[model samples]
Target: MKKNIYSLLKGKFLTSNGASQNWVMIFYLLTLAIVTIGSSHSADQKVHEIAKLNNEVKELRSIMIDGRGQLMKLKKESYLEKKMGEKGIAISEIPPHKIKVKSQKE
Candidate 1:
């Protein structure tokens, strides 16, 4: 079997056929390297994006906390009355009135 294979491969590799293999191997390596670099770059970009988003989320959370405090302050009726009074508004005490209504069904 070895003798038969050797006879079959005889003079088949004595030419520049193996030289072309070098370029083909280099091309394959270059393609693989480019793909790997591209994927790594994309991963880095994603990490940067995630970090940026995290910072934005932290900023929004801080703003929400500040807004919540402002909301709490504004929820007070006394605060509104004071603020409105500062804006040239006036208030007067009045008596409540009751209304009598009739049903449509007899």
Candidate 2:
């Protein structure tokens, strides 16, 4: 056991005879490490994308609220009256009158 540990520490496992199994295990570990690193990078990219989308959603929501407030102000009766006054248009001061007609039958 001590000899095996010493050989492993001295990096002699790959150069010694009957080292084919050791080489296969090294390749498997390397493949696993590469896959782990790639997955971590992919996860990081997804997190960044989600954060960007969240920021965009917040900005769009604020813009929509601002537009809605402006629309509400423009649609108000007082605001419309003021704008029309600037165009020399005025509301009628007199009340409207209705007419009734009677029909005669022979």
Candidate 3:
């Protein structure tokens, strides 16, 4: 066991008769490490992308709320009457009447 440990420590296993299996195992572990590192980086990028999208969503939501508020103000009766008054249009004092028609089926 001591001899085996000493040979392993001295890197003799890489030059021994059974070194082919050791080389394959080393290559496998190296590939696994590379894949793990790549996946970690990919996950980090996705997290950043999600955070950016969330910020954009919040910004869009605020813009939409502001636009809706402005629209509501513009659609108010007082605002419309004021704008019409500027254009020489005035509201008539007479009451409006709705005409009803009877539909005849042939």
Q: Pick the candidate with the highest lDDT.
A: 3
Query: Scored by CA lDDT, what does every candidate get?
Result: 0.86, 0.95, 0.97
Is 2 or 3 the stronger prediction by TM-score?
3
Candidate 1 lDDT, tens digit per residue, 18-102?
7577668878999999999999999999999999999999999999999999999999989989998999885667877899788
Order the numbered candidates by TM-score, best leading. Answer: 3, 2, 1
**Every model's TM-score:** 0.67, 0.82, 0.86
Steric collisions counted per model = 0, 0, 0
Model 2: per-residue Cα lDDT at residue 30: 100
Query: Candidates ranked by lDDT, best first?
Result: 3, 2, 1
- Per-residue lDDT of candidate 2, residues 1-106 (tens digit): 9998998899898888978999999999999999999999999999999999999999999999999999999999999999999999987799889887777862
Answer with 1 or 3, whichever has the higher TM-score.
3
| Higher-ranked by lDDT: 1 or 2 | 2
Off by over 4 Å in 2: 1-4, 94-106
Q: Model 3: runs farther than 4 Å from truth?
A: 1-9, 104-106
Residue 79 shift from truth in candidate 2, angstroms: 0.1
